[model samples]
Target: MAEQTTEQTCPQCGLDMPVDAGYPVWCTGCEWNVAPELFVYGLGGTAARRRELAGRHSEGTFEELAREGTRGRRARLTASYVLSYALALMVHGLSFALLGAGVGLLVAGGGNPVAWAVGVPLVLLFLVLLPRFPRLGSRVPRLERADAPRLFGLIDEVAGEVGTRGVDVIVVDGRVNAGVHTYGLRQRVLHLGLGLWAVLTPQQKVALLGHELGHFAGGDTRHGSVVGSALYTLRLWVEVLRPERWNGRVARVLVALPLTPPHHAAQSVLSLLEKVSLRGFPRREYLADDLAAEVASTEGARDLMETLLHAARIDDELHRLAADLSGPHETLWAQLADRVAAVPPRERERLRRVSALEWHQQDATHPPTHLRVELLDRRGPSTPKVVLDRRTEKAVERELRPSARRLARTIAQER
Candidate 1:
């Protein structure tokens, strides 16, 4: 139940605001008593300015897309898409050029010491600068079709509904998140976090799968090799250009001075590529949400979004559970579900408002959670095409228990 609100005077604006006993009280007119302690420290000079610029860009993008009203923008090759692709290609091209230069020098100047000196470093640098493919770490528990037919069948059903192929690998982990990505010649992999999965109802689970698989179906460019590889290469270049920490101020200056220009350049290019690539990202996300609604029903999709609001709390509980060595390992998931369910209605309201006020996002690439939810509300209700019944959920749960148990033991041991 919601706590009773009392009128309180805002210190900055003297405006009357309704104050909930344990929730933040703020003035709407002057925006007083907002999240004052949320600012990042040491982000003073250029860093501060860059963050502001990015914020402006995000605000503008959100407004523009929201105004456009979710028309048929899925997988449409806009000008921004074209430009982003070109930039990515250029980044890859540079790496190729560097490799060619080194090879040419070595081939032409056979026995020269200078050729060997320069060429070897150039070749080694090319190897270091290459774009990396994401792989499932050995520690993660992987589920196969034979091992979990019910789960795989559900995945395939959802995939069909979303108009995308099912994932080649399903890996369960301890995070409060789920994602799908391609690696190693377009092999699709899905990561299911038991922390989040444990708390979701069957319909919400369908919604979650729909949203992730929909990314592939909607042609999210960030998941594509061209832009994805470019982003990866740029990050590597930035890391390569950054100087390591040195003892003295003088030593630091000396080490940093020469690397500063190139480091800044790489960062600027990275920012540009990201800005361009992300122009249509919000639209793609909305499209995925649409797919989610189509497959799982609008109510289910909304419920899934609501559950995401409790993610931070879920993460905290997961950590605490992992740290409690004396606690029964088998009850970890049940304990998590119980704790999450126990969050008060007032707190849930607070979280919803906080998300709206903060423009809470899942990541840098995603639109604000509030915006996504609002868009869903605007679209109205949907009839589900697929459902996860109790029997199927039970079978799937049974298949997942061994993996979940192993993960729990690992977490406890590591802690």
Candidate 2:
């Protein structure tokens, strides 16, 4: 062998440099920038550049991307766990305090053991049952790959394209809706309602999957999942502590009685709390949609919006049919006639038209379809790079106010 020489060029300014000149063979000819680590990692050679281009050209390694995604997911879940514990502690303390105050009153009233026993159980109930109620121990269901291989492959391909992980895909057999969720450690799950699958064409399905991938890429699934879990726990606590199903007279009597007045008062306070918390759930849904849009393409967002609209129409029709079935009937035949009449001919025709449409539309817990479409159609990057405009910020702030208030109230009530 005479002499093996290597040729290298600066990727930035296209100036030639000799290889084996230590690291970062910066071209003296131009102000080109290259990280020395790239060379250290054996990614600086011509072959490496060609490989890089090839990797970029190809679909890329799904397994490598998924592994990275799993690492990110683990960090998010850890944070959620910490936050959940903190919130749980606050709720537990408040419940305990209320129970104590209620018991103290009963003690002053000739040391009533019956009242003590009743109060203790209520405390126990709040402690044991309240934290997990409403959204208790809900896990993202696992998707079987064998049943929907094509769908799973599509999901994996899309996820890889988006540089995210394919969440565990599940099929819910009904007319519900598709959703992506990140819940607990090592769990990112996507559920596609059978109704949605049945209705959507392959392209529409791809669009829906893209929209969901957007959710994962935008970190919406993790954020929303944690917030949703917290809300679930809080709602359950409120339900347990708050008075419900009690007659007005009974409630008044309970309120007036000094021995258990603290418990009644706590219950009253929680009723107000429940009313406030209910409003936040709707707002979070909107934020999640916005986040989803940021991750997916504008077309994906539009498709999602359309899907929601179609679902709403279908749901409305279903409700109408149900209403017709429940009407006052002269006989079985009359009931059948009523059911037939309940479905509006125009609505049925619309459903047929919607069904024939190229895209699949499914119901969502998001804003109205018109509003969503308007948002999606606006000319800009899917994810804004600049500071949000004042008007948009104000709208988001207004939407979040209720949740902020609930958080503040929870803090205050704990004190």
Candidate 3:
């Protein structure tokens, strides 16, 4: 039986509010305890400051987008955007210069021992750094058109509705997330994680597809080649420049003396790119959510957001099952499905309240879940552009079964 909700008086407002039992008590009138002072553990110094800046930037973006609406005119030529792109071009240019110099050294110093010694290392360095550029594609299990026609057809229908081209490839994995990314000269790949997909309703799955495809339609610059490649390069530079830990204090200081300045410089540029990209990402995410609402109906999109609230719980259960040596390997997904379905309403509401208090979002780039859900509520109901029927949904599930079993067994054995 479902638990009954009871009325409780708010201390500040003295208003009787209906709240589910065994959940956080907060006032609807005064909004008490909604954002209680959190006892955060490991936030201080540089990390704390970055967190503060990210939160402030994301919140500002949410408010601005919410006020102006997702369809509001977007200014593409902001100072931050220009500066970020300029830095990206500069980074790429420097990399090319290094590459050219390395090759030139090898060509000019043909057989000289000293020259070969110097040239070989430079050439090797270039080769070492080359893989980070234009990074594309993962090694996950790929699903071909013939393998799942219904699924691909559904994706095509969504792409049509969203005004984008269909994906070139679809890959399934064990992660509890899904995304769309470009690889190999703009070939789009859609990644579907069975951990999340298997439990979603058919319409929720449509919403997921709409949201991912919407990233393409929205022209997400952060994920685009220029900024994306630059971000990766800067990250690699940071890792390369980081000072090594030494046993002796003098040795550590010596290593730091040479590497610290360049390391800090690279980090500053990385932070700048991240800050600029953060400005664009929240708006793009909200726009994607808007597209998701359009394609899957407001109710479907809203429900999907609500489902995200329980993601941590789902992840925790997956980890617990993974760590259990005696757990049945064959029934991994089935056990997860049952556990998810058994999450009580009170716990769901508790998760919602926790999200509000923590200002939880999918990531730093995403707006808070509460804000996104509210934006959807403000947009009101939308008629779905596409719907997933039960038969087609079942067909897709059956098509995914082989990979699902393989992934499940892998997870089970990894313990």
Candidate 4:
């Protein structure tokens, strides 16, 4: 037989080369090697040329890469919460002080030094204490003995795989989703919803756990929490100082006669701050999903996405059945059973046979089913795509507008 030469091309560049030299055929033209998997998947032959062109054109900057690493909805929401609260407090304090002074002048005609003393001190105390008080000195409570060992071990194992410290784990007895939170330095805590534990498969569980870890790794937990706390307090002060017009006649009387407008405003501001903090809660979720992909495989991230979708479907059915029951206090378990029965017989059988171990909680602030599926579908080896459906985007906007308004009001009042 005559001797023959084998030729290969680089995936990054389009230069032809010898195949026998190595498994990863390098393109002499672009100086990039074709991934072995791409070759195995039958992109190795004539398709290799196409891949080379794709790789050459698909370049990204360091800044873009960094942004991808840290991108998370939760972190942004937390930041918004913090800012809104801080501004709310400032506005509420100023409003209260000015209003109190005005009222004191009108009532006592410059003879009420005591009113100024008390009012000023009260305002100062609120400014100094409100933002720091609620969130400070609070910790994620410990998990029970029965739950602690396995949960902690799993967290440690996942953290180890990602080259990071394991987060402190807690099991909250609620029908909600999981979250990772940081209070102070090295005080990371992972809270798992008992409902999630009931439904997720082992693989799905790990994926969800990994997702929470991603939040910590992305640096959203600790500093964001601190900022959120501060903002919450500030909002509280604003609410106390500037009660809303719709606060009803009784509330108006209370504010005008005893509490004063500033006090009412401060209370309103605080309530707004609390609500805004919740806004960050949702954005962190998207970031955690991205982190999950980075730490583990995209497959792992997909598992989490699927599990959440399933949980949501189950919860929605249960919620609808509960709404129909016409009782003040219907048992959730019974409602769930009724919901299960309402499904088609074939589907009901499948659900009935599902293990108790496969149920997740219902109250988590997870994005809807379609959105999660879309996100997972968009992920690949090279890069992950962010798919913000119109509904989620709209919800985000709706939540943010009120928060921004509160922050702006606080800023104006303070000035």
lDDT of 3 by residue, 1-415 (tens): 2355677887767887666554455665665554343543223354355446545665787777768776433334567668778888877777666677877887888877887777776676666555354434465569888998889999999989887877878888888889887665567788898888876888889999998898888777565677777888889988877776334688677776677887898899889888876677766787788888889998988888988887877777776776773654546777777777766565566566656556678877787888788888877888999999999988987888888878888877776
Full-model lDDT for every candidate? 0.79, 0.44, 0.75, 0.47
Rank candidates, TM-score, best first: 1, 3, 4, 2
Which residue pairs in candidate 2 have backbone atoms (N, alpha carbon, C) closer than 3 angstroms, thus clashing? 307-361, 307-362
Query: Per-prediction RMSD in angstroms?
Result: 6.3, 23.4, 5.6, 18.8
What TM value does model 3 have?
Answer: 0.76
TM-score against native, each model: 0.77, 0.42, 0.76, 0.46
- Show the lowest summed lDDT stretch of 10 residues, model 1: 39-48
Judged by whole-model lDDT over C-alpha atoms, candidate 4 comes out at 0.47
Taking the tens digit of each residue's C-alpha lDDT, what string does model 4 give over 1-415?
A: 1122487554445566655321344443443432333323323344545433431211222123234643332344345655655655565455456656656554664557776666566555545544342322434345533444544655676776544677653535334367766544346666655445434444455667667776565554223545444554455545545545337788768654454655665566656655554444434545566566655557757655645544655656544544454432324433453443343332322222221112212234443333333354455542322222455434433433333333323323433
lDDT of 1 by residue, 1-415 (tens): 3355678898767888776565566655665655444532222354345445544544565576577755344667788889999999888887777799899889998999999899987788789776666556776668878989999999999999888889888988888999988766587888999999998988899999999999999887777767877887798889888866345688778767777887898899999999898887767777788788889988999888989988987988787887874666757888888777766564565566566656678887777777778777866788888989999999998999998888788777876
Best-to-worst order by lDDT is 1, 3, 4, 2
